[model samples]
Every structure is written in structure tokens, then in C-alpha cells.
Target: MIALSRKHRTALAMIGFLCLMTGSGCDYRKEFQFSGPTMGTTYHITIKAPFWNSMTSLDRSIREELAAVNKSMSVYDKESEISRFNAIEDTRQSMEISERFAEVLSLSKQVWDLTEGAFDPTVFPLVRIWGFYTGNENGLPDEKTLEAIHHQVGFGYVRFDDRNHIGKCIPEISLDLGAIAKGYGVDQIAAVIRKAGYTDFLVEIGGEVVASGRKASDQPWRIGINYPDPAAPLDLVYKSLTLQNKAIATSGDYRNFRQIGGKRYAHIIDPRTGSPIDNGVVSVSVIADTCALADGLATGLMVMGHEKGIALVEGLPGTECLYLVKNAEGALQEFASSGFGKTP
Candidate 1:
């Protein structure tokens, strides 16, 4: 989940009740809530059912589904499909991949094209250069070093044959699916819940969320967007929306960042610049049909800034975005796409 500062946590607590309210009256539909750790964070799943059996079975199924996803995409796992592929040095041979991996790669390519390469997954080397990969905040790299590594990064270096589920990449190029994998995992868990005949549900991984059907109270699932102020408490909610059968993902520069000298470097690096973005836009929230798309787009919009991000979202169908920008005078300015404020 997006880590918030102490002040932001307090703000979040203040607004928590407004975002989700359980039905106080007795109802036939019972609510089940459970959570566990996954993907270096945690996941929360809530379901409303008229009749159910064995929470143990349900939890086991959910964990198994999520574990499969992690085994496919996690960079930290040396035995993961992606990590194993990264270890290969031959660019001439095409490698077979799991269906899930192929699906994510295809979607990532679409996002790469849509955002004009602002959302490339092949920039992991740049991430490492900035010390984001190891959590060590080293100073910036020299121009020559950046240029040399720049040759090794680019989505164009990757080729995917969807018909055969095969992937090919230049020897030096590798992928990091950190941005979209968690959201995809959330969607997969939501699928598991729906398959079990439960439609009224909410699945959240870290901060990425997907809401299905409605609450037992017949109210739409409500989600709160955190304020884009690092100094604010995590409980501080800038806006709240009711959504059903949709997914929401947010990307912000406030939480994950490194401070060097008088300047701060956000975790999100601009693939185009081969460096961390210093754009005025502080946070981006995207609502889409799938959490994976929302997660990828949110990161893309943050790199694109306000004007182009708004334009890109407006042209797309079944999508909306909210942009929070820190202005010159330190005031936060809000901008939303045409459909962002509409009732779902």
C-alpha cells in the first residue's frame, strides 16, 4: 500500500468512516473480512454471502491463486519465471512463458504504446542505477554511465509472440513488473471470489483495489484517495468515491522517495529521461475495468504530468484519472478527466 506520513495517517483516520460504512441493522447477507501478507505488502478481501462454508478453504484458494502470480512475476524471487528469464543471456532464442506472464506482457506493451513509452517495464536497469532496487540512496549517476545503460533499456527491445506465448528480448534488456503485478494479483483474487459465487466483494493489495457488486447494505463500495501531501497524516483523504465492478489504482511521489542534499528523488523513474521525474504533478489516480491497467496508467500519468495525462485519459474509453499537482506556491491543485467525477 502507499505509505503515508504521520500527519497523513491521522487524516486518513478522520475520513475512514466516510469512505466505508457497514450496515448496522441485521441482514441476511453476512460479511466476511480477512487479510494476509503478500507481494511485499498485504491484501485485504471482504465478501458478502447468504451462505458459505469453510473459511479455511476460501483462504487457502485465495493464497494459492496469489502465490501463482508471485511465482510468475516477482523480481525478488530468484526462481520466479521473470527472474529466470532475466538470467538468460541469449537474445537469439525465444523463450516460452506462462499464460499469465504473457497476458501481463501484452498489456504492458499496450500501455507502453498508449503512454508513448512513459510506462516502459524495461527500465529496471535505470531503477537500479538510482539505487531504488536495493533501497540504498546513492547519488545520481554520471551522464556517460546513464547513456551506456540507456542503450540497454527500451520496450522496443522486447518482442512478444502472443499466438505462441513466446517472449524475446535483447540480452541486456530485462523487465520489472512491480507497477502492474500487484494490481493483477488483486484482479486474480477477485476472480477467485466471483468464481465461488460471491459477487459482492472488495479486493485490495497494497493500495490497488477492485470492487465487485455492492455491499450487503446495498451501498456501492467506497474508496478514499489519500491527500498528496507527505507531511499530512495518512488518514487524510482528499476525495472519496463510490464504485462497483471497477478497479482503482493510485501513484504518488510523496511516500516512496529518496532525499539527497536539498533535493528529493521520487521512486518513479521516467523511462524517456533515464532518470527520476521531477514533474510538478505529485499524484495520479486511475479508475479502469482492470486493476492492472489502472496501476500501469496511474504510473504513466505521473510521468506524463497534468496536461498530457488528462488528454490521454479523455481519449480512452472506460477510464478516468484524477491528477493532484503541487503548484509553484506549494498549494495543491486538482484536475480530473471528464468522466472522473461521474457516478459509476
Candidate 2:
């Protein structure tokens, strides 16, 4: 069974209640908004079109697109494409996947290479061993266990082809797209909106967001980076930016972490170190042309820490990052790329 976090439930109660009352089609100042639960979270979409042929059909299409992505990548679903691939115990067996699955896996490989093994989809074993997957801390693993699990974690152990066939070199190797799948889901939802003859829109899944065109009022879509505090209100923003035809994704350990023996361990495990990131960095938000890229980069940056993360993001064209770090004095510090917040 899929277990929902308190944060997840709170998010659903906050947005799901409104969408439930509005029936997935709410009209506000010539903008139409719709939302629903998917991928263990909720998605909110706003279209600037003054009119559409059928709001119901458009809403259904958005949900269908999300379901398709969930069917392909959801690790919580035992029958999902990724889950089924994980169940394969023989190295000789290769699974033929859908085009969508291939696209996401390709992107995962790209991110893994870019981050120098920081953003690994094969870190599922580490995540589970660290207790973030089951939400039950079984005490920190011993050095021997960590070493064995770390050996199993790397994208290089997995093989994929241009024909959309994927296989693991060892049966113990598994994949998890939790870091990047939501952003891909956002992009897919945006495609559905665009296909339905809408241009100006905003699509948000979990915390990943994609903004296209401008609002009906002719203003750019404004998104706020939340303060990296578990106790902070959802609206407590550290910074806000106006985005037009861009995507932004934020990765932070503030909300998802386990405290072991008075020390906090983040959910984001470093595939390289085989441990939760203890770097002073608290949050990383990345902006790119696609939410998937932003999402993957954000998580990779978190594992890369502040200086290297900023340096890497600055070198990449058409990409920007903002990092929030905790200082030695226990204060929050902000580090951002030169082009960050210049979006308009």
C-alpha cells in the first residue's frame, strides 16, 4: 500500500479541498483552474484561455496524462513499469519499455553523468536501507552494510538501448525515479494543456512547476521558493520569481528527514558517499526549459553541495540555480547563479 506523509496529506487537504468544491473547473478572472491527486501528490493547473470547447474533457485529459506517467514510473505501484523492471532477477532478461519510459530513463542517465554520479536512479537500495522509503528508521546501517549497498548503487550497472530495452547487470540493482518523475509528470501535463489549444498556462506537480506564456492579465506566472523550514508555512517564501516559458524545481531535505540519535539524516542520499548529505546546504532550486531537467538538477545540486552546485549550474547554458545553506552561525545564507531570477 502507498503511504502518504503528513506533509503530503496536508498538501492534499489544502488544495484537494478547494478542487473538490470547484469540481476541477474553477473560473477566476477569465482563468480556469483544475486540480486532482496523482503520483501520491496533487497537481494544480491554471489556463489563461478565456474559453475552451469543453472544460471537463480538458480536465480529464490532464488526469489521463498524469495517470500514464504514474503507470510508467510510480515505484509505489508494484505493477508499474519501473517496479516490474525491478522485479527481474535474471541479468539475461531485458524488459522492453514504452517510449515515455525510455525518455525518462535517458534523461536519468544524462543527469547521472552530469552530476558525476550524484543523481543516481539506482540509489533505491540506499534510500530503502536509510529508512526514507519505509519511513521507519531501523537504526543507521553499519559500515559493511553501507559499503555493500553503495557497491550496488550506480547508473553504470544498468543497460539501456535505443530500442527502449533496459536490463540490469545484476539482479540486485534497481531503479527509482522519485527525484525526477514528478517534474516529467508536470511537463506531460503541460503538453496536454498545449494540445487542447491553450498557450498561457501554469502546471505544478508536487513542487515542480512549469510556466508557459503569460496570464490573462498579461502578467508573467509568479512562483515562490519556499523557506527551507519544516515548521515554515507553505506560503513562507524565501524568494519569488516571474517565469514565462520556463520550469523550476526545488529539492530540500527540510521536510523529509529522519532524526537518529539526535542527528538529522536527510532523505537525499549521496550515491557516492552512501550516506545522507551532511553538507550545510539546505535547499537547491533549479530553473530550466523543462521541469524534468530542473528537477534532476535540483536534487543533484543538493548532493553536490553549494559551491560545486553553483559552479556546475553556472556552466550549463540556459540553466540557473539558487541554493540556501545553513552557516556555521546557524543562519540561512543564499547563493544564486548570475542569471537566476532574471527570468521574465
Candidate 3:
């Protein structure tokens, strides 16, 4: 996945809402819109509700739900549940986790198994060694250091008992849930909106998004797919598609990376190799039933490369992907799954 710093994640697309005034033949509803900082990035929510008095209550509820998620999974929080688990060194001791943390872990395991371990949460050590976790760039680690740390990285080492809500790290592995947490946050906020009796809404955190029902204009939410061009001054939309009751996420290396000795190292690390991925794939966009699933799959597909990633998306249900790769002729080539809307 595209690496997001503690400050913010590179927004995948520019979001906008369309509003129409009330007229004789037009149907107009008051659109409640609000944005605020959360989870190291900004969150924007739009809801179509008949009553305008509930805005204050809805906003408070949204903030509280997001804070609850951060407390459960944020590594930057020293006292967070995941951080406390990382501090433990004993392999035999099991730690009890909250239901939210357990849910994220369970979803992560399913993607890990689906991608054959391509989407791994235990790659925090590798992320630090590559200087992604830290702002200071450390060129590259030696062969011995790489091999030793790689031995300690693997999702299989982390064991979880779903029935009892218990988790244990077999080899003292640290987890960086940067790739999947934002998506989970989006899902949580959507749930809060739905529970409050709002059926038409859009919830976006970082770049991951989940849309339900239609906008105030009675049109499906329109989302843009950004072109994966590093030379572009700003994000350029390659195509736009309508989405409802689903989630969309994009992972790309064009924006986040470090350069050393004429070699560029992307923020995304391949768990199987213990290094930054240099594959030709520049970006991957995934659409799924939930933002969390789309977010994890986008990163896993980026590591799997173009052909294999396309094949994997084809076999999965309720999922589609678009891959942008640089060919030998120095041109961008696009490969998309059968279900991915009109290809550009």
C-alpha cells in the first residue's frame, strides 16, 4: 500500500459533493457536511438527512467512534492496545485484546491467507529497517541484518484465538497496521452514520472511501481514479465511476519513496524479500464490499505485480483491480480485472 506518514496519507482522489437548490420540479434535501482531522489524516463526511437539527449529535458520535478506533490500533500511541502488545517480549504469554482489535486482526488474517501471505501485518521491523517508519533514510541494510530480521517477520508467528479474543506473538513481532487501519476507520464511521438512521452518506478517511445510497441529487457517488504519473504536478483523474454501497482504495509508489545513489526505494516493502518492491507496477486500485478489504488487497496486489495480481482479482468475488505499469518503451500500460469499470 502507499505509505502514509504520521501526519497524513496521500489522498487517492479529490472528493466533491453536488448540491441542488429546491425548486418546483426538483427534489432538494439539506446536505450535512463536515470535515476534521482524525487518524493522522483528514476525514470528510456527507450525509443526506431530512432533519438539520441532528448535525451536532452526528458529528460528536463520528469523532468518538474514530477516537475509539485509534486507541485500539494506533502504533504511535504508546499506551494503545497494539503498542502494549508490541512491548511484550515473552512468546508464550497471550494478550487479551478489545473486540475492535480482534476484528481487524481476523480480517487481516483472511487477506493474508487469500494472497498467500502477500499482505502481512508483521512487517513492521522491515518497515523500520527500510527507513519508512523513521524519517531518516538509512540507505539499505546489509545481507546479515536483512536475513536476521526477515526471520522474525511473518503473520504466521502471530497467533489469535477468536473464540476467546486472545492474541500472542510467537517471536515478538511488531505489527504496523497502517495499510488496513484507515479502511477500518472508514467502515466504523459508516456504521455510526447508518445506526443514526441516515441511509445516504459518504465516509472517507485518508484515501479509502465507502459510499452508501445516493447523493442529495439522487445520483450515485462519483469517484475519480488518479493517473499514476510521478511527473505530474498534481493528481490527474484518468477516469470517473459511480459507486454505492461499496468501498474503493488505491495503492501507489509514485508519490512516496526515497532516493539514494540513483536508486529509488519505495515505501512499500515485500515481506517475502525483506526489501522495497521494484516491480514495474506503479499503482493498484481495488474496489470491494468494504474499504478495509479493498485497502489490504490494493497493497497485496501491488507486491504481487501486474499479471499475478490481475489473475488473483479475477478469482475473487465482489472484488476488482486496475494496474498501471511502466513498459519498456517508457509508456504507461493499464491492466484491469474483468469487473473493473471502463478501462482507460
Candidate 4:
């Protein structure tokens, strides 16, 4: 597996990719396994039967799409499309972008509006200043530094046109897709798999998981919600959830963290405050109808904490979250909403 640290912080991943052989009821079978990088983490997807033969196509094309996404969205990358937009009079403001851009921008706006600017993409300056980005790590910025970037933050400062497929920023502001792009990638691959005429498979791009249909054994999709701990072994998973025709995404402050000057800092940043939200929560797992919704909710709930986050999920038309909070004794606690009761 290709291991990459998160702004939130991270560890090695031991993922399994399994494909069933075809015989009688299924005449052919194949299995290909590899660790694919995503969401600043490494993930493995096992395509079975017909797809095993086309593993190269899936790997090459998926990596390219992810690269394109990073180029267009990662604020840490200077030459990326989003970075370039914040560079200056980005003249290509009205030009057509890839389909992924359109979908992501729309989702970004929705979450930003819904959260009342809590989920802004333009908070990169603040994020970077607080050491959540590439430059700093577990180092708190002075008030002056925080103030300097605060003005450059806020989703309201960014502008885009969906009909014309264009985007623009205040030049000083940047976009970070750390919260949403992986789900979009999963959605893209799901669309691709559907196009490929595969009916039974599971696609998880960096924990933004989407399970299309049942396995050949008529079993529901099984997903594990990890127990977060930076000081312990990563492969030691403490929980697992099963789903069929569902999306499971987890946002936590566990893996991605830094300790400097005896202070522990997680990578999950609060856009409004330019710091991490120390909700007693370890991780937030959400199950929803759409991967995009689950991804956004996971991020939002991670910041909103347990009480408000659970309230938000309860009020939503169809959304569910399991809040894994850490107690004073360094133990994990669980909280779920009525919406979670509907999840299977």
C-alpha cells in the first residue's frame, strides 16, 4: 500500500481486495489486488470476475482522474487548477472544466450554504496557517498569522457559474477538496462500473465507500469503521458495519495528528476558527443514500461535534451518523441518532 500522511495525520493501511472465481453459476473468475492512493490515504479495491482482467485499465484511468482532481482542488499544490485560480486574474474563469469540477463545485456550494459557511473551500489560507496543510505540523499560528489568513477565507469570497462551467476566487483565496473529492471519485468509478455492465461489486476510494450490489454469496456489503488511535497499530480495527446499496464514510481526528512541544494536534481543522475541533469525539461514521452526502456529513459532523452533529442528522430528511467520541479516560464512546436506526 502507498502510505501518505493526512493533514489530519495517518498510518499504514492493511486492506483486503478479494474477487470470487466464476464457475457453473459463474463460469469465469479473476482477482487483482493493489493499494490505490486516495484522500491522502491508501485504499485497496478488489474487482472480481470480469473486472479482474481489466485491472490495468481501472488502475491507470483511476489514478489519472485522481491526479486531475488533485490538480483542480488541492490547495497545497501550487500548479493545480484551484491554486492557479487563487494566483491572480485567473483569465480562464469562464472556460469549461472537467465534469468532476462541475459536480464538486455544486456539492461544495450546497454544503457551504447548508452549514452557513462552516464548510467553506476558501478556508485554505487559514488551514495552511494553522499547520494543517503541507507547510506546518502541530504548530499553532500566532493570532496575527491567524488574522492575516482569516480575511482571505470564507466561501462567500469564491464565485462560480454552474451553467457556464466556470469558477473564480478572490485571488488570495484557494480551494481544498479534502472533504469531498474522494466521494466524487467513488461516484465516478461507480458510474464507470455501471457503464462496464458489472452488477456486483464494491468500490471504496479512501474510505469514501460505495457498494453497488450484493456479492455472489448473497451477502450484504460489510464496512468497517475504524477505532482511531495514532499511538497504536492502525490495522487493529474495532468495529465493522454492514450495508447494501449504501454509502459509508468516516471523518475522524485519529490517524492524522502531530505532537510538538508536548501538544497533540489532529489534522481535522475548523474552518470558522482556523484550528481543530476538540469534540470529545474520536471519529464520526455516517451512512447515507449518496456517497457525496455521507462524505460531507462526516466532515461536518467531525467539526460540529456530537450534540449539534447528532441534532443536525436527526433534523435532516434522510441522513444518519454514528458519533464515536473519546472519554476522559481515553476510551471510545458511541452515539447514534434516529436516522441511524433506519440504516441497515
Best by lDDT: 2
Model 3 misplaced stretches (Cα beyond 4 Å): 1-23, 26-28, 233-235, 342-344
**Predicted candidate 1 versus true structure: per-residue lDDT over 266-296, tens digit per residue:** 8888999998998888899999999999999
Question: Which residue segments of model 1 deviate by more than 4 Å?
Answer: 1-26, 163-169
Task: Please give the lDDT score at residue 44 for candidate 3.
Answer: 91
RMSD of each: 9.6, 10.1, 9.1, 9.8
Q: Which scores higher on lDDT, 1 or 2?
A: 2
Model 3 root-mean-square deviation: 9.1
Alpha-carbon deviation at 183 in model 2, angstroms: 0.5
Candidate lDDT values, in order: 0.87, 0.89, 0.84, 0.69
Candidate 2 lDDT over 45-120, as tens digits, reads 9888634234788898887888899999998899999999999999999999998899999999899989999999
**What would the C-alpha RMSD of candidate 2 be, to one decimal place?**
10.1
How would the candidate models be sorted by TM-score, starting from the highest?
Answer: 2, 1, 3, 4
Clashes of 2: 0
lDDT of 1 at 69: 97
The sequence of per-residue lDDT tens digits that candidate 3 reaches over residues 12-71 is: 111111222322343435678989988898899999875323478879999999999999
Off by over 4 Å in 4: 1-35, 38-40, 48-71, 74-79, 89-96, 135-139, 165-169, 260-263, 341-344
Report the CA-based lDDT of candidate 3 relative to the real structure: 0.84
Model 2 steric clash pairs: none
Off by over 4 Å in 2: 1-29
